[model samples]
Target: MPPSAREAANEQRRRLHHEADVVVVGAGIFGCAIAFALARQGRSVLLLERWLKEPDRIVGELLQPGGVAALKKLGLGDCLEGIDAIPVTGYSVIYYGQAVGIPYPLNAGADLGSTGGDTKGNGEKPSRPEGRCFHHGRFINQLRQACAREPNITIVETEVTKTITGTHNPQVLGVESTTRNPKTGLREKGYYFAHLTIICDGYASNFRKQYINRKSVVKSRFYALELIDCPMPTPNYGIVILGESAPVLLYQIGTHETRALIDVPENTPTASPAAGGVRAHLRNVVLPSLPKQVQPCVEAALADGKIPRSMPNSWLPPSTQTEPGVVVLGDAMNMRHPLTGGGMTVAFSDVVILSSLLSPERIPQLGDTAAVRRAMKEFHWRRKGLSSIINILAQALYSLFAANDSQLKALQRGCFAYFQKGGNCLDGPVGLLGGIIHQPMVLVYHFFAVALLAIWLVIKEV
Candidate 1:
């Protein structure tokens, strides 16, 4: 064969090796979810991941009621249900060593699953589902399995380096990646062209950073540790133990295991391995702060005096989409503290909105710069406010509990006492977190007003 003919053949082979209508980066929950959602819509999708399965990190183990609803919308309840994820009835905010449980959806954990048990046919859309808690690794594997079964989906275990955009315009055309390099034991560099690119590479997405020059704010306060065994029997309840310093959280997972996070501020000696030590700090500083019964679990878990795991509570700022035809979702866009565990749900919510808005009818017209910007504008506007609110609330709660602020501590106690008097104001934030209250800003304002009045009445009585 002629050298020219051989060269042409090699080029043709390279072109055939890479193809897709959409390319999704990061094969974690969000990436697999995007691939599944797009494939269901009859769009060809290629998903790239550095790992085949999602990491079993101390992240997103709990899904809020809203998150449960998002999974149902994507037909994931049955799969998740099979994994033995427990239903989270509500949340309890332990302030000043006092536990006040706020039941989800007016104290009734409603049935909103797709099995028609919790669903109501409004003739337009289905009702929301109850919150669920599962092992992160198990849940993500199920999602990957679902995506892999689809013919229109291709899951590739690889690393994506750069997002390629048009030279003339700033719209993303596809991505460049390394499949498996012979020298590096990874693959050679390759490219995949697509009409749209969804970046779900998490809070540390290279693609997201390349398009927009933003950095993540790293707060090295408390780290997390998971325990498979404890001294006492397991309970259904999860506790948020507030302290004058960094707060701690303890919860039961499954039958015999429990998870705990000892949140020590960066300035505190609690986080220092040499200052107080992890186990000693938990025993002397944190344990004495909790009830006697809870003390046993902490002691038993730290019996080894060496935690098997730890993770810093890091948060990322809101990401802006600079590359057109490319949009980021999930933690890649915005990340809050895991104390709330709403990250996955928030990402899934973005997927639903983006998928609906970017249907064939919309994508074709997105060719224009203004229209492309407008689509992203809507996406940003839709998510920014909510994320900001959640992040602020989570951070505020963390700071309030972790600090030695007499005023904040008093405020926390008074707020719970107010709720005990059948105050409806606290119900709104609960509803908002559960997906029952869609407009969180309005509801929160109302809550604030009611809280102000209640505080005033208490002051007058004094």
Candidate 2:
């Protein structure tokens, strides 16, 4: 190619620029929800996605009851329909061979009704107090479709390279992107100018470091397996098994398919079918500990010789922000272990709070950095009410279940015993886990109570 022609092409690419009130990067759950909410309020939104097709992944499969309520408030209750999603009533936990059932609080139904109302206008709620779980890809597609239906939202299929910033101030002005044709392999560069840029890219977001200066630490990893024809002892309840090696979670994702997530230490040897690695680990360490009804499905899965999918479990402590005109959210902003299945719940809750703060009545002009910054300040604090509870509970619970020390194991026993008490004791923690409760102090109180119970039990044994 000649230099003159190359220069001409560069000039053409530089001339391409689009504008919107808000530019949202990544079309995952958070991005889609935020775009839908903003568009519904008559704001012009540009939602960008690298892949126009539905996403396939193992995470974000479960939506807590609280998330369901938030979805209804957003008028997205119907997204849960036509997906063959399964209802999750509560949890069935097996600790050291003893088992107990913890149901969602009785007030959950009323709570849903209070906030959700009859979104369908049929005088009935589309969701129940119970949660729902389905294929992650299908759920995300529903959210993307919802955004596509909004008149104010423009969906773009492209890759966002970086944020466009102001000349003097540190405020964000827009985003730069690149588009590629799948058939001809042609690439084009473009820019999107907006008053505010919202980043909802997933856990591995590239824009996160540009906005926040914190690093996510990997605590462990989860190996996922799909078990066909698996039936839980309690059909409606998800199961948490605390065995000797690590904790295992089992829940039905479809009518005939169940998903099992087995926690593996970061240092554990990788599973390989060639060396009989996964088979040996399951047969020797995991299989013997499972309940009788679940053994057959796990055994069949092992015999199939396909290695399970693995995902890193990471934690990022909340951080303060000083940047203006840019808001980083979802897993990109904060993440907790998937053991509690709260990722989607946290994301939805963040959208609910952020959308409310960014409503037209709150900020008349989208480009007003002063107003957006002020609302962001309130958003940062208000989000903690729910995010903190869920974050602490997930970390604390994973510690108890993945007990690596004798002290933690004792606490794990105490935790199970505490649940076996069968009243406020179980309901309190379960409510927090299900996203109904938002009190951090309530979580601290329950945590210490379990510790005291563990100490008491240990002393009695000695």
After superposition on all CA atoms, what RMSD does each candidate show versus the true structure? 6.0, 6.6
Summarize candidate 1's per-residue lDDT along 1-462 as a digit string, tens digits: 775564345334324765667788888878887788877776667888878845677666777776676777886666576776766666666655666776665332353344223334555443223577677888888888898787667777778888887889778888888887657884688788777788888766675566656666656445556566553222444456665546676665545556677776555675477866665666678778766676776666677767547666767767667567787777776776766666776777777677666666676543455566677778777865455556666665565555466666555655566655554655665666555455657656854764585577568767
Off by over 4 Å in 1: 1-16, 107-129, 181-186, 220-222, 229-237, 364-371, 384-388, 446-462
TM-score of each: 0.84, 0.91
lDDT of 2: 0.83
- What local lDDT score does residue 242 receive in model 1, on the 0 to 100 scale? 66
> Residue 306 error for model 1, in Å?
2.3
Winning candidate number (TM-score): 2
> What is residue 44's positional error in candidate 1, in angstroms?
0.8
- Write one digit per residue (lDDT tens) for candidate 2, span 419-443: 9898889778888899888888889
- Where is model 1 poorest over a 10-residue stretch in terms of lDDT? 111-120
Assess each prediction's global lDDT (C-alpha) against the native: 0.66, 0.83
